[model samples]
Target: MNSLEHLQEKVNYDKIFDCVQCGYCLPACPTYETMERETHSPRGRINLVKMVAEGKASVEDLRDPIEKCLGCMACTTVCPTNVQYGQILEGAKEVIEEHDVKSMAQKKVEAFLFESFFPSSNWMGTLGNATWLYQKSGIQKFVQTTYLTALAPMRLGRFERVLPDLPSPFERAFRKRRVLPDYKLRTTVAFFTGCVMDGIFFKTNQHTVELLRLAGAEVLLPKEQTCCGALHSHSGKGLSAKELAMTNIEAFDLEDVDYIVNNAGGCGAKMTEYPHLFEQGTEWHERAKEFAAKVRDISEVLVELDGLTFTTPVPRTVTYQPSCHMTNVQRVSEPPRMLLNNIPGLKVKELNRPDFCCGSAGIYNLVNYDESMEILDLKMIDVIERKPNAIITTNPGCLLQMKLGVERHGLEGEMEAMHLVDLLMEAEPAAK
Candidate 1:
């Protein structure tokens, strides 16, 4: 069978037909706005899928547009017909992955990333440890000062400047597992410390646990939890994503917890859609539904508690960059804003296009370096207009991307990027 036949079998024809071609998603699309090409727009991509299904286009023709998409799902939010764009996009991605011929180097990298690195906690921990050593042993400084970083890829070298200070392996090993509320415990939740979130942004994960405790919840860290498989799914490794999802479902056996809480918006959104990774009526499908139903973003849980007391006055202006997945997929928007408003002395400034993507759709910045930077630069225009003291984000990817933006725009000391949970922790009473 040809690639078109595979697509015909894999693609959801019904979902593609849902697009009314009204172009409602054009303005909301970062690639559409940046590239100024219809092929990159949500409606255009949907049409391409429709064409591929109808044999008017080949699978190769659909590869570029699908790969270029951030998978942010912003288009779904504005669609008048409520097109299941994400499902269609994922299905097309899976078909492409199966049919497309990749170079040996690309295949090896994908194998390592999808089959080996991401799914292994040991590797992620090693990465954190290696990063810690690089920072602490003066190697990082020497490399930066000597311009050795220039020898690396352009995107990687630029990203090195904004990499978070990862916690040492020793620190991570001894991190707290159960955090009890100082006052009454309103609920119990199992915290899902994501792979990259825990490996790179370990401090933020720690802060999330503390913030949850402060919000009157008993927090339990499930050690068996693996990577959220978001990167895998977005990159078209659906089978790998499903394996990771099943591992997480078994790890987070959520029979007793009130919710399975997560700090990263991308991870949380993927976890909530676990059911989509499985077929209906299957045992894993029912299990995924149960797992997904319990998934909740940290902001959602915090807002519902309404028990946190802020003592320190932030006395700073900050603009929020909503995570596209958190907003469009998880359907969480107001809760994050509500929490920000509750902070004492903090002013929340709204960006011109507040819901726009920061071009950090998972690994987009690394893979499509030039395109991602273009989108980031476009997003920076709104950031420059706000000129807030800090840019706040819910997802780790958005936080890093905004940090790179702050650096690129020469606003380093004047501006900073922070995760929402960290900001909340900073506002908590000093006595802690």
Candidate 2:
């Protein structure tokens, strides 16, 4: 007669049992290593879900462990049984969102982010404009110096340190546009300039497109595409993520392009997994599969092009931080390094535990500040030890998190964090 016995449709009961609990994932899991608690590990979370399915545990029992997860998917990389831990985590999240109790503030923030800002580029632009003015007008400086952000709600104070300056003059020029290569185009691609990638990390997107052009590919920024819905899907809003996927499928003219380029690793991973969102054999499902097939990380696309050449000498020590989505989800580990190695005189230092999460698992650092900082500090330990002039990564979230780490460790004078595409563009001779 337990409520958990009547498992909801959202919970994948069978998948929950896939975990053999052999503890293979223990060393690979960041949260488990940090918290040293059984509840925060993959095996523990999978067991909790299975328990809920079997009426041994309640939805409430699953909340803390699931929420604490970085969703880095490092466990999946080592799982011998091929357990789709990411899928299980997503299902568990859906179940939590539906039945778990949430505060009014939590509900409001989710609504604002998923419903209000994430679905539309206009909202992103509007917010981006305000942020631009805040930085430009010196108000941000005044507030930071005056400690006024401490008075703001929702720990906006700590979050403010992570905000990067918005790109000017170039922001409007890059929106929903197309750029043709000056040379004979080897191929054509549609670029997925994501919500956060476009607004906050706008310059990275620009550099991504420029790199694509230099590699001899025609780039398309289709006007009809919307947010990649990575945040929504990661947060358990499956329906919302599906809606955005459908809109994007219709947006890109797949007939005309050879690849759908995604510079942001998180978005690339989600977009490439679009087929899983729809039931097999549905029309939308077929479309999702086709759309997903074309999605490639910008690094992957760049590596595929044979015409790439770097005349500019970067001549700096650099380390690479692989986004969880890029390494684990997208299964892309080498293309960025291969690209980096291509640059003349650039010292590509291998970061110890390159696959570790930088504490910026999407909005993770924002919601779970203390825990996020713990992970970030661990990451910084490796970063400071490596002592690279710059840390390059494939996703916007990682870029911001590493930048924050630089700021937090007072290493602003010593090191910088940048996107892979930005590094490539900088190393391009024409860019000099």
Candidate 3:
């Protein structure tokens, strides 16, 4: 009983009840738009949570609709009444895990892999080095269609959604002069190279560091850090997520860094939630809280830095796609835009329905391909209508999904997709 209670950590319910049902968040709510169901809507989920609190509904009633949610917190951003719905959903997941416990067999398998595979540089490096080989051989399909589905408990999306064609790991890139020199080192930040980002989008991480160094930061790469626990948490293996967080807390605390900045929005969100996974708190709990407090989205850090004067002349309209985790979970629209606008001669045009999810909710694109495609189609149409020269976003998932989507739908080469850091790097320092 104690253990179960510990799992369902206490949440601020009073804040949850403050939602005024204004429906302002509806426009930003992706799941609501996808299903058009009350239960999937933010208001409806809060209602279910209220019922669950009152013992009027079982955890089973809250299972499917809630699980179907992408954990996007766009609803909270638009809510004038100040409902912290994201925190509520994460807390609700804990409660469901404690009481309901459905899908144990599948979750058990995921727990094993996420805990084992993502924690070490060696394991991830080997796997990163193998992705290109797998694609070279005709064995990619069998591994993609059969092995991944069979070995793993769930699907993230279609074949293209989660396919990270990583040639070299981010660790190797960092180890081989992937950074620039910083004179002052105003702040030393540790980058959490998440699984997919570390492997496939290694250049993005490099760009992130370049941007950081340009902003007067000395970036530290903690060689011991793991997956940031987001993969395990999303896969219904909260225990593994907790263990991963503990490992990260220890590794990150090693350096005398000012803050931990993550390019991956999912990792940033998870790092911010580390404290909630604890019971009544000890020294470790305090340590996790301190780390969480220091966690910063890459944009957040870049925007906050002094002398981030941009010299890159975009000279054309650039559409911005905010990741669901960054937009909803982290509530970071202004920082990204602020940084983008800093670039000389750049026009920051908003994507139609900018807050809507791109349907690449972490692994959601891979497992729920049909729904994911539907969402991405909506976004693609919006992007094509704008006719921007480039689409800059933060998350790798968005880059992948948006890239694959535009190509398949024959919008190929019409618009380019890249990370905000990629553009930030183009901003040259004032010439001596």
User: Which candidate gets the maximum TM-score versus the true structure?
Assistant: 1
lDDT of 3 by residue, 1-432 (tens): 454334333334566668877778776777788789988888888888777766677777877666767776777777898887866776677667767554454345445555556656567666666766667676777766665644543442233334645554444645632244455556777887777687677767767777787777878888778888776676555787788899999988988777898998778888988987676558878988999989999888876776466665767778998887876666667888887877888888898788788887766665466677888888888988888877888887788887766665776556667778777776664311
In terms of lDDT, the poorest run of 10 residues in model 1 is: 101-110
Query: Of the pair 2 and 3, which is ahead by lDDT?
Result: 2
Candidate 1 residue lDDT tens string, 90-189: 8888877887653343355466566656888777888889999999999999999998878874346787889988888889889988889988889999
Q: Report the number of the highest-lDDT candidate.
A: 1
lDDT-superior candidate, 1 or 3 = 1
Local distance difference test, each candidate: 0.86, 0.84, 0.73
Clashing pairs in 1: none
1 or 3, greater by TM-score:
1
Off by over 4 Å in 1: 1-5, 101-112, 430-432
Q: Score candidate 1 by lDDT.
A: 0.86
The full ranking of all candidates by TM-score, starting with the best, is: 1, 2, 3
Q: Estimate each model's TM-score.
A: 0.95, 0.95, 0.82
Structural RMSD, model 3:
4.3
